[model samples]
Target chain A: DTAVSQTPKYLVTQMGNDKSIKCEQNLGHDTMYWYKQDSKKFLKIMFSYNNKELIINETVPNRFSPKSPDKAHLNLHINSLELGDSAVYFCASSQDVWGVSSYNSPLHFGNGTRLTVT
Target chain B: SQQGEEDPQALSIQEGENATMNCSYKTSINNLQWYRQNSGRGLVHLILIRSNEREKHSGRLRVTLDTSKKSSSLLITASRAADTASYFCATDHLYGNKLVFGAGTILRVKS
Candidate 1:
């Protein structure tokens, strides 16, 4: 079974349109994250949720909103998508390990959602 | 801003050769991890080296961490065509819960 899964593997829409990408995890992890990979292949963290609570919010624009309905689900919705929004969005989950030795927790990622804004 | 930056954005090697990629971070870290992402697949964790540990090995993969230099390296021995993928280095900061990833190194192993 896939540990982390994201829906809408491919998305192509016109600029100014709205879109949503859904992500779900079954690894029983308490922490989930959203990462965006640009054309340059620079992977950057966009947001993170721990047990349905928003934990980390990067400098992403307000047009990108992340909603976590539960501990296992985190969805990303983009309003008024722009041409610069064309990129692959990845969803990942990991155990909520904090403090010392927190880096040992390996992240499980989804295949990713490829979004294209024409 | 990205905390980690990988050297040699792209690399090409023949089958049976070894490939090495290096990463340098700006801040102190609890651990540094190496991940592999196949063409259209998600990133898979390959190895993790703690700040206190200098070297770690898993199968054909070897990882080394230098906290004093804030850098890490991932080496794959006897690489295969199937090993062609993008390798990324992620750092877990001492003050944050997120993993800051590098730009990635694209490795092409020609069989």
Candidate 2:
């Protein structure tokens, strides 16, 4: 079974349209994260949720909002997307929020959702 | 800000040859990890080395961590064509839970 999965593997939209990506993890992890990978293949953290609580917000614009209904699911909604919003969004999960303590628990990533804004 | 910076953004090598990638981080880290991502796929965890540990080995993969230098290296031996992928280093802070990833090194192993 796929431990982590995200919907809408590919998204192509206009410049001003809004869209959402859904992510789910079956690993029973407490920490989930949203990451953005640009064309240059630089992966950057956008948001992180620990057991449905917002823990890290990495200076991302307000246009991008992450909602975690529960510890198993985390969704991202992009509002008024711009041309620069085009990138690959990945969903990842770990055992807990503290990476140091969870020595053997590395992040489990899902196949990314590629979004393109014209 | 991105903490880890990897050397040689791209590399190409023949099958059976070894590939090495180096990563340098700005701050102190509790542990360092290496991940691999193939084309059109998600990142896969390769190995992790703690700050107190100097080196670790997993099958054909070898990882080295130097806390004093705030740097790490990943070495893959007897690489095959299937080993062609982007390798990334992620550093986990001593106090925080987040993992900062480096710009990956793309490896192309020609069989």
Candidate 3:
């Protein structure tokens, strides 16, 4: 089974539209994250939740909000998207927020959702 | 604020050859990790090396961490055509809880 999965592998929407990307992980992880990769392949963190509690918000715009209904699922909802919002969104999970603390803990990522705003 | 920056944004090598990518971070880190992402796919975790350690190996992948220099390198031996992908270096801070990723190095392993 796929460890982590995100819905709508591809999304295309007009500017000012609202959209949501759903993510779920069967890895039984404690922390989940949302990342955005631009055309230059620069990956940036958007939000992070540790056990369903918000732990990190990397100066992301208010229009981009992350919702973690539970520890296993985190969804991103974007409102009034702009041209700059076009990028690939990836969902990732880790056993704990700390990396390599106990036996090389690393982040497991989903295939990613490519969002395009025109 | 980028945590890690990888040099030589892209590299191409023939199969069976070794490929090395370097990463430099600005902050003190608890651990460094390497990930591989094939075209049109999510990234796959490759390996992780703690700040207290200097080197680590897993199959054909070798990772080295230099805490004093705040840099790391990932070397893939006997690279295969299937290894053609973008490799990224991510760092988890010693005091912070977030894992930050670098720009990434695109590797094209030709057959």
Candidate 3 segments exceeding 4 Å error: A98-104
Residues B34-96 of candidate 3 have per-residue lDDT tens digits of 999999999999998988899999999999998888999999999999999999999888666
How well does each candidate superpose onto the true structure, as a TM-score?
0.96, 0.96, 0.95
State which docking tier applies to candidate 1.
medium
TM-score of chain A for each candidate? 0.95, 0.95, 0.94
Model 2 lDDT on a 0 to 1 scale = 0.92
Enumerate residue pairs that collide in model 3: none
Give the candidate order by descending lDDT. Answer: 2, 1, 3
Against the reference, the lDDT scores of all candidates come to 0.92, 0.92, 0.90
Candidate 1 residue spans exceeding 4 A from truth? A97-104
Error of 3 at B110 (Å): 0.9
Residue range A1-118, candidate 3, lDDT tens digits:
9999999899999999999999999999998999999999888888989889998898899999899989999999999999999999999998876542543368899999999999
DockQ value of candidate 1: 0.73
Model 1 lDDT per residue over A1-118, tens place:
8899999999999999999999999999988999999988888989989889888899999999999999999999999999999999999998864453445498999999999999
By summed lDDT, the worst window of 10 consecutive residues in model 2 chain B runs over: B91-100
Comparing 1 and 3 on TM-score, the stronger one: 1
